[model samples]
Target: MQIGVDPGSRYTGISLFTGSDAVSPKPVAEPAVVRAGVFSIEVQHRGNQIREKLTARAALRRGRRSRNLRYRQPRFDNRTRSVGWLAPSLRHRVETTMSWISRLQRWAPVAALHVERVAFDTQLLQDPEIAGRGYQQGTLHGYELREYLLEKWQRKCAYCGVSGVPLNLDHIRPRSRGGSDRASNLTLACISCNQTKGNQPVEVFLAGRPEMLARILAQVRKPLRDAAAVSSTRWALWKSLTVTGLPVHVASGGRTKYNRHRTNTPKSHTLDALHVGVVDEVTGWPVRVLVATATGRGTYTRTRTDRYGFPRLRLPRTKLHHGFQTGDLVRAVVRTGANQGTHVGRVAVRSTGRFNIRTATGLVQGIGHRYVRLLQRGDGWTYSRQPEQQPA
Candidate 1:
């Protein structure tokens, strides 16, 4: 079996596929059968944790420098970043993906690996009509233009201010009326607005609302800040995946989308992984999709520490409290309390016998451990959701 992986920051899609001619108890009839699944890495404080810690550390340093200026030496040699240095959050994503790949290899005989190494052509995305020497004159590059448009238009129809509607890229000045297909001349409009505004100019269309026209023009000119820090790390992830000693096949984001659309499958990470490459058809089989979620084992630091890195409360010496760990999935039936109902989710074991159950709605704290029944042991992985079936 070969594996197809679509790795993202939070969720990694995985699919195991067997060739058409592969022998089975029941005769095989499909070109390929995809066993799709998603891996959701539940990192405690995932991305925000790193940001918070860095901010806190900086604040502390600033406070210290202000208080003791004479003793504190000013350091000025930390500006440059070394080669191939990835941010903590991005590195965590890569590590988690690799870890899952290693874990899955034990269960299946993975012959090859296919990954979507998406590299967005910022030039093409910003200005789709640019050809030949026109590329040299373009000023705006990267996803900033798209981000700017979305922000300026507030991700809604600029004409009507209607949100949650299917939007389309529309020309403020109609093409028939000599409008250049530049970013400045573009705006997002719902289907209704687009049809209503047919070939009419922005001024004529918004004749009744002069204020709206002024606002739209002003928003179009405003440029968005560059996102160099948020530049993609997909290529780096692709490089890391190549070390698995298997034949690695790489596909682009566009190709993946085209395949997915051709197959008429629902949009999802796992579904995308299943249709990563040139998949024409898979007949006579109902595809099973597994959803894997990461549930961390209890942390080494027992106590709940304060912002100043000081222990706030003493935790239990033993990790297991009444045969339940912090990350274990459990069903708690509260007999009597403010929240007197059955709550099911990951449990946060406490030393005082009052465990915290994280339900779908929110965390229900102060629940007695006696009421919690272990649904699944904390194996650092949880498959809470059932496998999704795709029609043949």
Candidate 2:
């Protein structure tokens, strides 16, 4: 069987498929393919874990430098980064994807690998008007425009100037009032402002604040300066996949979307993986898609450290305590307490006999390990829900 993979920063989609002669050649025909199963490997902490750690480390370093200003000599010139050095978090994503592929190879005879190399064309996305030679001359490209807007407006609501709230890209002129989605017409506003100004033109909504309205208009007209193109780590992943010796087939995001639409499948990472390459129409395929969440295996370090790098927790001396390990799916039956009744989720083992159960509702801490029963040993993946059964 051939395996299709769609790798993302947070999740990797995997699909096993066979029977190529089933799909009709016509685009309008009902497209179908037989698949044993499709699933995703969801990174437990996502990329934020790495980011948070880096931020904390930086803060600590800054504090140390300030305290030891005389003792610590500045060595910025001596420190140098190696070529093609990826941040630890991003490298983790590539490594994790490769690890999943290796594991899958053991279970099934993977004849080939299909992967989506690039999801979007950065140049075209940034400058829609630049075609042919204009593409070469276009200054603003990719994420720079978005970054510019965020910085230009000071990451606050244009109307209210409220900071530290969730902001969204908003249109100055309502679409209903003939507004365009161009960068010039776009601005960042807090959720409250956006909802309140819904379907209203900028002038009408900002009538009370003439000075702010003027500032907004002027800022929108001014284009952001050109910046260096930001490179993505997906290219690094592609390079690594090439050395695996397996026949790797590359596809584009456009083709994947087209195949998915023709098949009339719902939007999902796993389903997208299934539609990564050309497929012939088939019949009687199972409708259910497996939603596998990644629960990391227990790390080598058992202790949890504090911000000052002091040991705060020694965890459990034994990795497996009472036949249970951290990340194992468990069902806790608590007879009485504030957290009573049945709670089903992954459990965090403790040497002290008390465990933490992470459930769908939330984390129920301080549950005795005896009350927990192992439902499934975490194999780095958990099928918590099916696509059809997802909440509307």
Candidate 3:
């Protein structure tokens, strides 16, 4: 019998399997040849990548050929491909380990244990074959959790109670909205549901649907109860357990091995292919943007769709921005081309050699002095901030 226990501090799942009776039968009362594994683990993590490297350039490019013609190339960290540094903090790892230990102590009695391993990373995150690049920081952990959850649920969603292809592990709360990697906060959702929910709160999507919420709650509750029923002494009965290798390598190794593994580097990492979306003034819908890549150019045209797809061309608009005229009562909205959709202000009052803008809403009062822009005057506004300004 080979039994695997997937354990976490907050949650634990157990699975038991027997080899053919002819091979060996230390059969427990359960007669089924293959039994489904229960999932009851939650991996938790904290810190996140905050300030990422934008870029760094050489002080001077190839100046000119000298008599000897020697050249000095700019140097930077090849792993990150820039001169910047990555300050990886420990908010995620500590919580995950805590969850694993908590589950291991609770659910050992009923489930037979041959080898117990915590899979923190998955093939996509670690396998050089799939990921040609260097060890991406969270690749292993993300992949591992997905694989474990899929297998445990027999590739079915824990919610919706549907089984077929494995469901993706989705966050009940979106990470973008300040959710941490807590197991208690994760759930299995179908691909359709996952995409639809995207970075939004579960409650926001569920939106007062009581029946749907009940189903999802039932799936999570059952696995937890089963795991808790097992006794600790039962787990002690298992013969052997092994901790699986984490996909991410620790920083203990010297720079020699680090350099060797860091062979895969892209020719150049441009900010191209960066998807920037904006609320379209014309359509009243979110519009995809295509920004020009030429240096010192902050112009972006709307993306156009044709036979194949959007052919990486400019978005055409009748109004072109030639710097605002003096006292135009212009809306000094952030330059979309240069600022990349960051809004500065809704209305900026022209002052002595500077735009004096009042806060549009109460929220604007708290923002610091900088980053304010004049609002782009739409069809309605004749005077920028005049009391008469109203919708057409």
Candidate 4:
């Protein structure tokens, strides 16, 4: 089995599969997903939050020096950053991705790794069918513009927000009415919406709903930030992957787009991962994906501090209570209470023996520890399953 990875700033996708004709087994064999999922890395460590914290600390330090260093000599250039150093938040993306890659390698028979690199020049992308009319083919066949639109529209119909349907390339302002084939003038719509909106100007078609119409117009001009993110960390991730001792194969984002379009596969993070490197054909894939969000393995400092570095709240010295620690995956069966069903989720331990469980829906509080059984120990990730795409 080989693993393909779609590394992103916020979500890193993983897809494991065995080739169909590669001397596989009889019953348990095919070009199918062994397992696939995305790691929600932004939940625990977003760059903005880390940057804000650093800025706040710097300002606070300046204030303290103004008060206490009036009689003392001011020190400058006391700290050193090593060569090739990355900001904490940016480094977290690389570290987190490499950790999951290592974890998956240990868990499965990962023969090799395939990872998608940064975007290639538009010149590298070519479609034989649309070679002459380059701009006209962007929404469907061109890699850069098409992928940007897919991320922008979220692989859904822009008009009705309906997904899982083969969307048609739509002109927001009808081309015959004066719309240019620029990227900003384009959107996506379901077949029915496209037919219903034939020849009618967007302003007149959605005159009743000014809000959605305005939102769509505003979103058309929005830039694709995901491209910048992938570009920033692509080389870092590539260098880290080199040390794994696996035959690491790499390709450009444009190449993945080419492979995906050649096979006519729907867009998704995990599916994009599955088509990262060389592939003859994608025969089958799992409908459900296992989402493993990186939540971190609890922190050393238990105190919540204010801006001036004063302790605001102090957590318990002992993290474990009733033989269960916070962040542990547990299933609680309440016999008689408002929460009188089976609830399986991450548990937040309390000294009172009543823990709160964070379920997929929400959080359930005040459940006694006696009813809870350990399902899996928390290993810096929360595991859950979600359908790859809801059935239309």
Q: 1 or 2, which is superior by TM-score? A: 1
Residue 129 shift from truth in candidate 3, angstroms: 27
Candidate 1 lDDT, 233-297, residue by residue in tens: 56676787788888888875555666665666665566666666656644322244455665446
Q: Which ten residues in a row have the lowest lDDT in candidate 2?
A: 223-232
| Poorly placed runs, candidate 1 (over 4 Å) | 19-45, 67-71, 123-167, 182-187, 201-231, 282-324, 330-344, 359-367, 370-383, 386-392
TM-score-based ranking: 1, 4, 2, 3
Model 2 spans with C-alpha error above 4 angstroms = 22-45, 76-83, 123-231, 279-286, 294-325, 331-344, 360-362, 373-383, 389-392
TM-score of each: 0.69, 0.63, 0.26, 0.68
Q: Could you give candidate 4's per-residue lDDT for residues 319-383 as a string of tens digits?
A: 87988998899999998979999999999998989899999989999999999999988777787
Query: How are the candidates ranked when ordered by lDDT, highest leading?
Result: 4, 2, 1, 3
Q: How many residue pairs clash in each candidate?
A: 0, 3, 30, 0
Which stretches of candidate 3 lie above 4 Å from their native place?
A: 1-144, 147-155, 217-223, 228-234, 239-392
Query: By lDDT, who's the top model here?
Result: 4
lDDT of 3 by residue, 118-137 (tens): 22223442353464445444
TM-score of 1: 0.69
Summarize candidate 2's per-residue lDDT along 109-151 as a digit string, tens digits.
Answer: 7777888776644455466765555643443233334544565
lDDT of 2: 0.69
User: How much lDDT does candidate 1 score?
Assistant: 0.68
lDDT of each: 0.68, 0.69, 0.35, 0.75
